[model samples]
Target: MSIPNEALQKILQEIGQKKAFAEQQLAIVKQQMAVKTRENRMLQLTASEVDSLPGDTNVYEGVGKMFVCTPIPDVQKRIASESEEINADMSNLQKKQDYLEKTYENSKQSLEQVLRGGGS
Candidate 1:
């Protein structure tokens, strides 16, 4: 059966709204992925730098809002642990980004189909 113009317009509008929302979500996911990637890189670099330092090297680590004096050995261990956590976070965010990309593509395709009057 042929669809009514009003119903088709309504379907197109809903698809347009969903498409816009999905685009925003995708943007947010990308921003979060970038932040996670940066954190992962910095953690790796910090761990590498700490590894190269002499065992007697003096270093301070941030505890919450303040940097506390910590022994080089302790700093090294903390860096190693933090690096692992950051890597895990990066992996999770990567997966999330992949999912979001797929969702964004589907939303775009749906919008295109609706615009072409291929309402479902």
Candidate 2:
């Protein structure tokens, strides 16, 4: 059975939209991943620097524009916790990126099939 030209056009349009949407979502995910990765790296570096400091050294954590003197151990713990959270966020973003990539590919394939008259 042959599918009507109108139906084919509609299917193509829908698939194209899906492909575009997925592409946009993928870009967003990539940007988020980049941000998280940078944050994680900064945390790692900060942790390293803090570790090199003497145990009695005073550390200050920025709070809105002013720095408040904080204990070394508290600073270390805070850095560790922030690093873990950033890593987890990056992992989740990676998963989302993978899923979006697959979705975009599938949409592209479907669009191709429809264009080639194989979708009927």
Top candidate by TM-score: 2
Give candidate 1 regions above 4 Å deviation.
64-66, 118-120
- Give per-model TM-scores: 0.79, 0.94
- For model 2, the local distance difference test gives 0.89
Worst 10 residues of 1 by lDDT: 111-120
lDDT string for model 1 (1-120, tens) is 667888888887887787677778778877887887787788788878878888877888878999888997777677778778877877887787777778778878877876665544
Model 1 vs. true fold: TM: 0.79
Candidate 2 error regions (>4 Å)? 118-120
